[model samples]
Target: MGAGLPADDRARAIIDLVRGQGYQTIEALAAQFGKTTQTIRRDVNLLCDRGLLRRKHGGVELPPEDENLAYPARQVLNIEAKRRIAELVARNVPDNATLFFGIGTTPEQCALALSDHPGLRVMTNNLNVAMALTRNPSCEITIAGGRLRNLDRDVVAAEARDFFSRFSVDIGIYGVGAVAEDGTLLDFGLDEVEMRRSLAQHCRQRFLVLDHSKFGRDATVRGGHITEATAVFTDRPVPPAIAGQLKEAGIRLVVWSDDATHTASSNGRG
Candidate 1:
């Protein structure tokens, strides 16, 4: 029973269980740990506040669907793939266009890749992305200010959303929590979902950048779908079934690799 378990141990157990199952109700979780509903609720709230999990109506779920790890931890995972995907995304942008960079590792990598490109007007809620651009003197960067979230290191309040509403951009680069079988873009937080939707409205072209791991996963909140993107960029070749759906929807799939012929052949499979 959780009564005899240390607080840290109990919290770790809860996290492990939630990660394995995706989501669990408060009552169910409490019963499993032999703790009162109130105690479990406190634990859930604490975890949510720490950006570990998201609190839903009935229970708690893992933090933003695509990323099961905390933000700091996620930046270290898939480093090479994210770097390659970012390079591809950076190459697609025009030199002097206004860019909207969304929150997440992929976007941050893209921002880093863009450091060499001067004369870029960048607007983002991600501190990391903004910082990356600011390191280049020739790049102009604007950060949306609001309540900063520790998990993704981005602003997610109404003020930030309102600030983004004031400007349109040539390109908007976004990352996903997960991609559904039918190409639906998903995330966990309602605020993130709303922010992404708002950003889509202000961009002439939208790009979804993610690794292959993001596919076949589901999130608590649905952002925009693949149809909303001008192109989908990734480090891996997407499965044929998923590629066919994107092709049917008129979304271009761009796989990044040093060997063009190899990439084409690799991407041509189911």
Candidate 2:
């Protein structure tokens, strides 16, 4: 609700808000931003034209439930939050740990954070993660065999899912396309979801890395839940109900904000 922000910043904020809230009316948006309805309408029109949002009768929602944002846009959106989450996840990793890094920008950022770590073995279907680890001379990277996905720069074919099942790693780091308010994890397609499931099943510890915008967001395919993770890392605290579930499941919640990380296990352990 920072009305002083420039138009582009406001538009991005609007997208995140609508994504978290499902839909927002023009008047509601204007009131939230302390702007006029006419100004909000103009912004909504531009967002609709760009296919980033869908204009309903008197409100805006996400573009399409079946598709995700363009990869480049997703890469830059919530960039700072993703970096902080990634760094904290990396700090928890041991120097010689073996890892399974899954698809998405957040995983790639985690790989980047581990660049200076020694004696690491990484198995990944994400090309970006593999390339990021290549910068570390002491890290060993194994990539899955499949035709690369040009859009996401990762492979999520059936064989890739099978490839993940063959490894029993110390940790699995992954990101989801969206998260339902009830704590269900959603992805764009079955292959991606299956691949993530396989990674979870094979790893000793599962790290779910995501930014706050993913909460209440929509996606086509749903496979896992937040409780499946050993720890959930994000830039903001999750919804109260979901946090309660995490506590019940004894999963660790790691929040990164204001340049500091706060970690607590659901069982009241630090």
Candidate 3:
């Protein structure tokens, strides 16, 4: 007897089978599921729209090759947690102090948190962060000059690094791609890695603003180690293994939860 299945279940099963093989043509999926080509086409389109898979010329595959593919959607995910982290960073900023802001959504939120603060000098490589600070008339904002990277929305050429080197700041707030168990920070591109390193040198104290997802993954390049940072502001508690590593390296981990009353702080010295 043929495999018994409901219509929806059969469609899902076909998708699962094709996805497991990497990518399959429309004809192949339809043949395997014993369905009409039109039905499979509709399923592929629906899955593509929902971001479950990507539609291509021949058939459906995974998402396209783009370094910053999910970046645009990241601002909406875990938004409340990011806001809380941003507020905590803002509270730590001294009034009228010069600060360096790095790229990504977390730093963008930090910029928003500081919007009402007056008389602050802010320098950054991120277009979004610079734009966010523009609404605050009392804040002096400057963008580092460099080749603008469209994908990441930041200036990251050698010129930008040189421009950032010209001034020193009291604090540097940066967003990193990943934080390793051994405390190494990682990012996708070398130019971004270099830019972050330059910003780290120009500031007296460095603060890494990251959310929970960044804790365990490592990207292509290393930006800096966790020990280089004065403090890390994250939305939730880190894994015990990662936390222990940070502590051994002499770094401070500060977690800001949704509850206003609870704050957890720990320190490690390398």
lDDT of 2 at 176: 96
lDDT of 3: 0.80
Give the winner by TM-score: 1 or 2. Answer: 2
Output the better candidate (1/2) by lDDT: 2
The per-residue C-alpha lDDT of model 2 at residue 112 equals: 92
Give one digit per residue, the lDDT tens place, for model 3 in 189-226. Answer: 89879988998999988888998878776577876787
The TM-score between candidate 3 and the true structure equals 0.75
TM-score of each: 0.72, 0.78, 0.75
Candidate 1 C-alpha lDDT tens digits along 1-270: 555678778988888899898789999988999998899999888788767778988799876644456786568556789998888877778788789989888999999998988799988988989988888788888899889887668997877777668898899998888888877888878888888888888888888889987898767788777777788889988877778877777777889777743333223112
Which sequence of candidate numbers ranks them by lDDT, best first? Answer: 2, 1, 3
Q: For model 2, give the 10-residue run with minimal summed lDDT.
A: 261-270
Local lDDT at 68 for model 3 = 38
Q: Which stretches of candidate 1 lie over 4 Å from their true place?
A: 1-67, 258-270
- Tens-digit per-residue lDDT, 1-270, candidate 2: 667879988998998899888889999999999899999999999887766788898999986756787776677777888999888898899999999999998998999999999999999999999999999999999999987889789999876669888889999999999999899999988998999998899999999999998998889898999998999999888899989988988888988757364543356222
